[model samples]
Target: ERPEEKLEKPCAAVAPKEEALKPKDMDRSTSDDDDEEADGYQQKGVSIDDLSDDWVEAQMKDVTVAVIGNVDSGKSTLVGVLTKGGLDDGRGLARAKVFNFSHEAANGRTSSIAQEIMGFSQSGEQVLIDRMGTSTANSRNQTWQQVVSQSERLVTFSDLCGHEKYLKTTIFGLVGQCPDYTMIIVNANAGFQRMSREHLGIALALRIPFFIVITKIDIAPQNVFDENLAQLHKIVKSNAVKRQPLVVTSEDHLEQAATGIYGKQVCPMFCISNVTGEGLPLLRSFLQRLPSRLQDSGLFKPPSSPAEFHIDSIYVVPGVGLVVGGVVRSGRICPGQHLLLGPDKVSQFKPVMVKTIQYKRVTVEMAESGQHCSFALRSLVKRETLKKSMFRKGMVMLGPELQPKAIWSFKAEARWTVGFDFSSQSILNCALVSAHFASICPAAVCGASRNVDVPVQLCRSHGDQD
Candidate 1:
């Protein structure tokens, strides 16, 4: 072919707007050069599949594990201990391949307490998902929904406020909404407190599998440990928990303890020290084993990150905007995502933008379940509106829904492990799903609170159409 015909055909064939091109454009053509370079790269022994695993991991989803327990019961510490090896800087999850934190502490310690925890997960990626324990707050409230959208698996672990003041509320909120495998941490020296019994009762009612970790074993007197174990046994037996509890006396003895406690029973105990790093390895091994057990029973459901946002608190950020606080209940939340604002049935949840994330009380880029931190939103939402949007107590903030009229109340199915009865009509101060209550429904009985199915409700109603 003629040289002119060849040149014209190459450019004209590819360019739909051939008439718009001039001879100047033809002489300066770089398209062929670009194609050659691209072809060379493709010919190099590397395929897209050969890219670094880290790059692939960034695009994949991740699993979520929620950490839950009463306040001061070592929930955060336990998380720190469990993930000590994964963090980029610190001793815990910070060293992991998927390390992400809301904020860094003064000692250069990364704060794992907020929505930032979600950053640890990498779907099908060889990264460990580490999470922290914290109450739901405004900033991280959108996490749950994010998790459901981005993850294939989720493990929600709740940490309840352990103070006697919030025990009932915390326990009630955790009742049927968390993980099937629960790790209940108790202060060994304190023995079995009344709240522990209450917590156990809720766990039992849900038929969730669980193991107990007796914290502060390093400081507990030998007799105290024994007494705690005895008390725990009595509580379990009295409650008739379907699964017997496993007890761990010391880290060194975890494997032996695990072997001994493998039967179907009530709460079992494991001795651990969050400060000393004792029993962590065994604990890790046990955790890794749980997924297998779930699979063996043909009941294996890879974790599902449900849409749940637990708001912690609401505050104003310096320059960003209105900020809410709390730990994510189920899924993950991202910086630019919008979330619903109100009640379950009627209230409409307005979509709001997530501006920033603050974890462990410090600001960061992203967040997820298990961390306790604050997050910023584009606009300020009404506090009451925010509260009504949340579903559970630990749920700090939540996506909005229809106007809330009757609170979403469910029947409490529990086995009474203590002397209390559900028959008595005394004012039963309780908190479920984070909303508080002091008066008992005239229908409730006393000590029979076990296996007691009580109708619970949310207070707010949906907004009326203008």
Candidate 2:
């Protein structure tokens, strides 16, 4: 009886003129019995129909780009220079700013998946990282909320591992983050190598559109750079890749790429030097205009739908307790809200209350779709302690409106194949084959149960059935 009353008061007192999923807590004043005052309040209310499309877009605009390439290809350096607003010293200085661990900095290799954001002003100015050191204690110079708050637009880059040993980690970052686009780094002197092809193939297989960037032009000989550039052009135009390559050297080429690069048909290539800052401006301009594909497809919009969050990574902070981190798939989440967290070992979901919500290390009022957030949750059931061991990868936080299930069993028809190998990932008779299907998507296979059909086809690999 008391819970019903508590819900009714918030619904009745707030005027519809307020933004949907208002970040700040709405004033919960006692209801008045006066008829005239009620009439005035009704006049101020606004509905979803009253808001324009532009208003909804202005509220949330986020684009994610995954930086992938072979080891020693300057992937991290490019991301560091782009977000940190600094150039390399030619001795691995710029990339040092982006490394997470001291060993990564010392070895000059990115071993883990790192994310850094760049905010763009309304007038087309790059928001550079300001200040430094552990006083702020974040990967970026300032907190993510501060950068996002100061800019009209946000661009997030997933700095992925490029070594052959970390191939699994690279795949997880690519499929998990669901970037709007992928930026493939190519070393001008070394040219496109084996691991570069692997990254490109993964991006292509997942149907993710991408652009190519040639780095370290300052040190590479002119002849060597041209040879690599020619090889890249030929590959993009080959029967396998089948995408038109546009070498962006001027503003005109940039315009052409911007108009048609959204799809997987056209591929844009850029040549830049981290030391000299040659083609950085052109890259920055394109990033500023790059549209969020999710927004264009109507997936990213007003957070009026039932809220959902998938936990991709988990952390147990010393002071904050256990925190789960992931991207908001379709709606908004706020602190003190109730959500179902689950499908643990026993296929059970525990109702938990979000104690705090932080986006990129800064506390935020509300986290919307397309933003990466960390949630500190508290169990709603009294005396129930959520053991960290129970929570597994691919768990989700669902709203009450959504009905979830733990599908421990399902039937699928495997296409008949001759001499096929099921030994790659041990995906014989399960639900998902690769990490792409494991990305915690909307149509997850309960196969994780949305009445969706997920089919698996085995493609030939290394002249062997796989």
Candidate 3:
């Protein structure tokens, strides 16, 4: 018998016993049958409650994954196929949906940081696909709402630029966004390039757990693909990273890899073809089962703590005035709350009122720590003084209680140095430094003593601040 038939047989058999025994006996038998069926379904990886007509909403868990690689590595195409629930036409049909600019579509390259999200239901089914078996823009928005309302997990992908010229933008995406994990794509036919190595080094330096995805397997020759896979395994297991390489081929391997992903010891590699849709299901399963490392670190600030939101992108809408989008690094933010926005030319923060808040394109009254959202700000300064150029990336929106200050000089311990020839009296000026929050700015370095301690002074790079 089919699995569903077998699961329902016990329940159906117990229904006929309604008149054969006492009321209490019949109730007991029915309860026992229900329990048996539920157990059977659970053993087969199915949830009994998920099959019910009455839908109970689940608390959505957000996970950010950054996609990094070299140009033509198929990063955008893979994400488009995964989220849109459609295979590529072996051309650029899938990637066109994700390109935000006309030039990008014409050149078939991504120069800026783009974002796309995929949702998985409690039962591991993708929620973005519609009844017609295709995903449209409107359907995707609707699916996001439905998925957020019904699913237990949501995965947001930050698609970063892969070209060498846009390396700075890619670095900003990696550092400023603070993604939970990194997904590095490598073209199977072309093998790993210089930028791929650079991205991997950045991920390693940041101490973020990452995995590898080998794409374009449908076009690569069998011998060439095998050779590339062997080389990838060698590099991952080399002395530099010292990580165990695991190739996921079955469900058992996938489950074991997903469980060990947080440990940072094993690097799981997936081989997928966006055109043929091979091995995509296994990748989706791994992503769905992957746990958020932020929660594991216990670093999430309590809601009662002071609010702090890091600004990464700024925009001026015609009707919305000023809108800043970024992650809430700590605490909570709500509408109509007053906060400080700056580290201006004089390292002073100015007051601003939050007019509105948005999460995943849906307006919300409050946004909590670790959540990425956009806030519409209403400046308290005079209209003449309020200029969009005054606000730039790497600034923070902080609660007034902390009395935050933008420091020009700070001491830091050196972990390691590379390709540097510095003397004790050397003063490196106009150098760009990236901090823990991924904010990069021009600064001056001084006092590099023998004890490996250095004091750096930050200076405003633009607008005649320095």
Superior by TM-score: candidate 1 or candidate 2? 2
The clash tally of candidate 2 reads 2
User: After superposition, which runs of candidate 1 have C-alpha atoms over 4 Å from their true positions?
Assistant: 1-159, 172-181, 219-224, 247-266, 274-278, 292-312, 323-340, 343-466
Q: Give the TM-score of candidate 2.
A: 0.77
Q: What does the lDDT read for residue 440 in candidate 1?
A: 13
RMSD of 2: 10.3
lDDT of 1 by residue, 271-292 (tens): 7776566766566555533341
Clashes of each: 132, 2, 0
TM-score of each: 0.46, 0.77, 0.77
lDDT for predicted candidate 3 compared with the true structure? 0.71
RMSD (Å) of each candidate, 1 decimal: 18.4, 10.3, 19.2
The residue-by-residue lDDT of candidate 3 on 1-466, one tens digit each, is 1122112101001112222323233234334444454345335442322332111112337788999999999999998888888899988988887776778878999998878888887788877646422235565556566656666688999999999888877877887788889999999999978889888888887778899999999999999999999999888887667789999988999877987678988999999999999999999999998887654544455555678888878888787788999987666676656577776655566776677787876777567777789998866544433568877776888776666655444445434323111122322433444333344332323233335344333222331121
Worst 10 residues of 1 by lDDT: 6-15
Candidate 3, residue 385: Cα displacement in angstroms equals 7.9
Q: Sort by TM-score, best first: what order? A: 3, 2, 1
